[model samples]
Target: MLIRNKALFNKGLMLMGSFLCVFVSLFLPIWGGHGNGLDAADNMFNRLSKGSSYFIPGVKEDALKLEGKSVTITVKVKDAELAPRAVENLVKAGATAEFKDGAITYSGDLGKVLGAALIDADDLFNNRGPAVLERYAATEKNAEKTIVKAWWAVLDPSIKELQKQKLIQEAKVVGQVNKRGLEPGYNFYGINSEKVLDNVLPLVGLLAFYVLYTMWYGYAIFDMFAGIGLGMSKPKTKSEA
Candidate 1:
């Protein structure tokens, strides 16, 4: 009885261990969150259809590729009072800021600009330090927002137009050229289908592991039941009888 009980306990432990391993494997990747794949894809598509506003001359085309592009955009603004406001606008516009060496460097997307605006407004009332610094900071913050907004607004409209043009071209090519047996030309840009698939691989892998874990647990349960059945099936030898 002691030995059988020990064996049962061991089996239970083995089952628990297997279950834990499977659970950890399935959830570990999910805990890391869905990476910036979707964002990167959007940016890539935007860049492909409409040129990037931030793209500088001499920057390698390959560098612009979404495979390893950084989502952060950094801008420097001078003024201590402006720094806080600038940071605020940056945050509103979906950005972050750091004050360094008399300059506030803001990094983010369109949302960051809104955040900077908010910061600038707040500083107007709260800033009480060096008047010179405060005045300059306020001016700098406003200037930065105006410049950024103008550039982005201009680029935004152009991008929309470019997308429209691309769509029309694609439709014409597909409907007329392809039908006529000429090679169909489609503009390839941004994140391709393969990349999207790759992005989902982590999620898929997690689900696959979950399925595997279920199978393993089911087998373990069956094995335990089989052991119990075998123990019951053994004929009892009654020596005293």
Candidate 2:
């Protein structure tokens, strides 16, 4: 085939090189929230996403000794509409969730569950106006009033302190990383189809180079073959006869 049609064969080789360039460009990895300078935050998200359970030196033993059994931390929010959403959020963040008695039952590590429940419940009310959230926080609606179920009391202050310090966004991303209703492109650490598109641009550049090189090399070879054919077809000189 090469002898019969050198030009066509060279063009075919150039076209094939373009595919290689596109393949690599689209799949190149880029930094993401999972490990892109967010490992601690990401780990927190994973832990909370599984369940807020954690090991304290003595809390588990104390709960066994004092409470007479394993205790399930729970809370009730005032808004019925937001209550169900908060329950769903808790479940996604890795805790057991049930809606009962106008409340959310989240059985997990107290601090972790406490943080998620409080932050998320209020997140539902965030749009009503800052004044409304301010009233909720000021009144301590985030805590269970009874001391016996006060497993979450400590986190109440800590969360407020963070809010006081204006670390609200960082404070919540731990659980928010795995929440529903995220922005369309908020893919945590997973590579989305959009990222694959970025790779396409790189591949296009590589394929361009490949195509250009193939065209030059193919033309050179084809031109050389054509010259040989022309010489062979010429009539014999009189001197040789």
Candidate 3:
């Protein structure tokens, strides 16, 4: 190929080579405590995400309104071993629970039952899995799955029964606790918490790098094209009458 602009060509080569170097560095284990650049960025975002998803406090407010509301429901436990643990959790929450035939018939004030769930969800959200296990008399093996899963099994049906009893607000509170509390807690269990303010610098840096890197590639291509005599030019207008 004929060399049209040697300086532009060399600049492109330099930019592209440097860009490639940075790209390869992303996979290297350089970020302390969080593996590579990719992993570190993902970890940072996960922590920030978990930090932002704390909705337990609002749900608790909703539950407080239903403090004296009463509910009675029998939820069948698919896992027989978890049945007793589920009953224990209910009883500990100031509910009367009878475990028979792999189903737990529980009765209590609506607020206390939901409050207990919120406590468990908060613990799990804060990465306190052992606290939940201990609360439910559960062992470490499959601890989170066994305990959290049991809570879900019981609460899910209780919400349905509450709806059947026309306790709409009460049911909504439990649903919110499950969605905003338990799910996030379970999903983001092991991630370290990071506030957005604490990570403002790095977060902004990553976003800025993303924008610059995209432009970096575009300019590299443009420079290379210009060096090869492929630059666009404004068309000359015909001399008028």
lDDT (10s digit) by residue, model 3, range 47-126: 99988998988888887787888888887776778787677778888999998876789999978888887888888888
Better of 1 and 3 by lDDT: 3
lDDT of 3 at 111: 88
Q: Give the TM-scores of the predictions, in the order they appear.
A: 0.23, 0.21, 0.78
Q: List lDDT for all candidates, in order.
A: 0.39, 0.39, 0.82
In the range 1-241, model 1's lDDT, one tens digit per residue, is: 2334556656855886778775565544443445343453344443333322222221222212312211333334433454555455445445565656754444444322322332332222222123323433436534433333332322223223424545333233222211211111112211222243434665466569668878878766655655454343667898995
Query: In model 3, what are the clashing residue pairs, if there are any?
Result: none
For model 2, give the 10-residue run with minimal summed lDDT: 180-189
Q: What TM-score does prediction 1 earn?
A: 0.23
Better of 1 and 2 by TM-score: 1
Q: Which stretches of candidate 1 lie over 4 Å from their true place?
A: 1-13, 21-30, 33-195, 230-241
- Over 114-167, each residue of candidate 2 has an lDDT whose tens digit, in order, gives 344433332332222233334334344522121111213222333344455565
The local distance difference test score of model 3 is 0.82
Error of 3 at 174 (Å): 1.5
